[model samples]
Target chain A: MVDIPEHLLIKTAEARAKALGISVEQALAEMKGEAEPTTISKEPEVIDVKPIEVKEAPAPAAAVKADIPAEVDFAPETRVTQRLLTVVKAKPIQKPTSEPVDKVNTWPHLMLPEFISLMAMTAFLIFISAILQAPLLEEANPNITPNPAKAPWYFLGLQELLSYWDPQIAGVMIPLIIGVAAFMAIPYIDRNKDNKPSKRKYAIMLWTFFLAGAGTLSLIGILFRGPGWNWTYPWIDGVWFDDLLDWVHFE
Target chain B: MKNEKIKFRDRVKDISAGLGDSLKESSLWGSIFRPGSPFRKGYSDSPRNRSYVVMNNVLYHLHPVKVKRHAVRLSYTLCLGGLSFFTFIVLTITGIWLMFYFRPTEMAYVDIQSLQTSIAFGSLVRNMHRWAAHIMVIVVFLHMSRVFYHGAYKAPREFNWVIGVILLLLTLLLSFTGYLLPWDQLAIWAVTVGGNMASYTPVIGAQVKFALFAGLEATEATLLRFYVLHVLFLPFIIVIFMAIHFWRVRKDGGISGPL
Candidate 1:
């Protein structure tokens, strides 16, 4: 209703905007009655114009609902673009899937470990040879048999068995049966398809029994049996046991 | 002048290149050898090239193109089979060296004595051979136990288990025969006890003993028999079965892992 000069009108608008401490856009919006005038908060209002694209997280469904128009006219292009956005927002972002599950390369993986292990074993054997000396006794005299003249350490188990049972059974038949039943015929006898030891308890127990039995027999024959194949605790006699102590002797 | 410098560099390059090219082009070598092994140009970390590397080499062909990660684990296998093979290799080398100075006569004892006392590094080699043999026996038995405990003897691996048992028997026989080669009193009596076990067979008891001893007792003939068996016959048998054993390991789906 009142006419004001252009310069004065512009100055008044500027003064009002300064007094309100609002942006020109907010001031203009308030003048046009599009927005309500309010007191200024302690912190200045900040607005981001561009949408932030998050690579990891999918847009929440609620955010999508706020963005999309509540009702849409049947305009093909608008509907199609909205549908594409919805589709794009639906998928949760994922990191790229890593290496395939089966069929790994063996050149470096398998052979490298084998090479390292072999070298280590070779070094061990060389080191052992450096420290230990081979045993060679007096020439083979037909008459003088050493007391406790025993078989090789491996056959010691059989000899120990010979002490308990008939030589035929101990040396020949039992070994033969064991070789056939345990080693050769194991798969046939243990028809269980499971590879887990817990599942094949009986088979594992039988195997453990035989292994413990053989190991015990060999240890007994090698150490416990002394002169004339008689049982003597070499530790008590203090000859070979003394030698063992000397071998392990620390300064 | 620059041309001459470039020419010299080219010549050096050509010479190095020719070394490999000549090897590749030569009929005998070329036919036996294949290119693109692990370090070669075509080699890569891809599954195809890895498989080619295995399938292309004779020695490596014993392994499968691909193996389960668990199969090759140290905790699982403890590498007892590989250690047994390694010990066998050591024994063969030392055994051959010992054979050069050894004679299968009454002089056998003297030769062994000299081997321990006089020969260059003879005692060291002999000690290694002896220890390796002993270790091999224990390792093999442990390997058998490992196989059993792992349930590796199931189904497709049954025949390999049988071969393993035969190898075990051969290993013991080999040690027993070599035990007598020392010709000491210990050797004589131990072998006598071992040989006497053969006489316990029900039907062919005496014949078996006679066959082993070549007479009523272990004589010079028996010495020669064991020598021949130890050095030649048993070794040959072991090599044959060992190749089969290794081959079967791959064919039966590498070493067994979890079910």
Candidate 2:
């Protein structure tokens, strides 16, 4: 082995490091025949290994697998699992659940398009009314009696009912009583389980009769009867009958 | 690479100048656009906090606690039995509008006449209100019929049915009270006759009549009574009933039958 000067050795090491694109310390360490450079401060402190107490996770997967065998076993049973097995069997047979089926097209389910169209039609009607300033008859001149100074169309039916009976019985009392009774009876009267229109025959018929009777009676009373005091008319002459009819014309 | 760096530096300088100009411009814009700014408190963005924002809201009770989507869509759409409810909202709007100009006095008849002829769109408002009122009655009847036909009033819904009956009477009362407000000969006579008829109720007829009219004849007091009943009293009753009605629908398995 030949001896070399420390300064020259350091210069040569620097040159070699630059050429190799390595750090000076790396080259120096390699020249010294060291396996690894003393770069890191110290070996990382070893952590103590303690035994872990691990609780097993719930056996959901095993339970699911077990359920199949349990179901298979249940399938052979006659009484105990019959209903449950039937339900389970049915689940697989059924198509996947989707959106609900609409049974009767009731009022609350109006589509946006239909609602818009309805609103448009209503608006158009209102516009036409506005444009026309829809003629209003002379301000209900009480002194100068008009021929058919009638109640609005809806009340005309009730007005007609006034003609046939006493105002107390026919006009106010009877109607009120009947109305309250009818209203109270609604739930009781139509207690069928069926929601289909076809199944509700009696209910439909009863309602139809009620509507017709109310509307027809009101129309007849309003149209035929004359207004206020002294019921006898030239055409429909009986005094009491005319009085009854006049009672109906109050609205 | 040198050229690119120079270009990048110039771009950065340009961006910095632009940003400064924008900041200055924004200050001027802010000054110009500034209106009277009210003081605002910081609020929590959590949903539970948001819910309390409308604690005193009028429409809080309008909606039921729990609603099945199907029930809402069905009840509010299609055949539109629920459209009657919308009509009621319209009635409320138009009614309040009418009240702005109307005086519920003995002069109500003449006031109505003036509204018919003199006020702008007054007759239209009146007519719409009148027609809507009538339509509401018809629609309600039809709705009841539909409910009956569908067997929606059975079992747990029986109490609701009873409530519905009360609602129907209230609706009729609303119509009747409104009718007397016009105070024309028709209104006067109709109410007089109606009052007299009440006087025939076997035992409490006269008392009922007196309570209703506030006197023997249908006078200013009667008009005021009817006005209060029409606008305030009956409305309160109906609203309370309506809340129960809607809530019951939710509780009773949401309109019945299979979904």
The DockQ score of candidate 2 comes to: 0.10
The candidate maximizing TM-score is 1
Task: Kindly report the interface RMSD of candidate 1, rounded to 1 decimal.
Answer: 3.3
Compute the TM-score of each model's chain A versus the native chain A and list the values. Answer: 0.56, 0.42
Which ranges of candidate 1 are over 4 A from the true structure? A1-101, A238-251, B1-33, B38-49
Per-residue lDDT tens digits for candidate 1, residues A65-113, read 6666868432333211122222356655985687443544566457667
Go through the candidates in order and give each one's DockQ. Answer: 0.28, 0.10
Question: lDDT tens digits, residues B1-259, model 1?
Answer: 9998566434322222334655545677545546546434323345566677788888787677777777667788887898899889889999999999999999998898888789999888887887788778888989988888888988899999999999998899888898888877667777787777778877888999998988988877889999999999999999999999998987887777655
TM-score of 1: 0.71
Best by lDDT: 1
lDDT of 2 by residue, A1-251 (tens): 77778788788879878877778878777777784534445445454444455454367766666645554542232322112222244346667777664442221122233456448535754654354332233332335544444554455575566556776677567666787786687677666766666887887788789877987776465444554522334345422222133234333
Q: What is the lDDT of candidate 2?
A: 0.61
Residue pairs whose backbone atoms clash in candidate 1 = none
Q: Which stretches of candidate 2 lie over 4 Å from their true place?
A: A1-156, A166-173, A189-191, A197-200, A227-251, B1-79
Q: Is the docking of candidate 1 incorrect, acceptable, medium or high quality?
A: acceptable
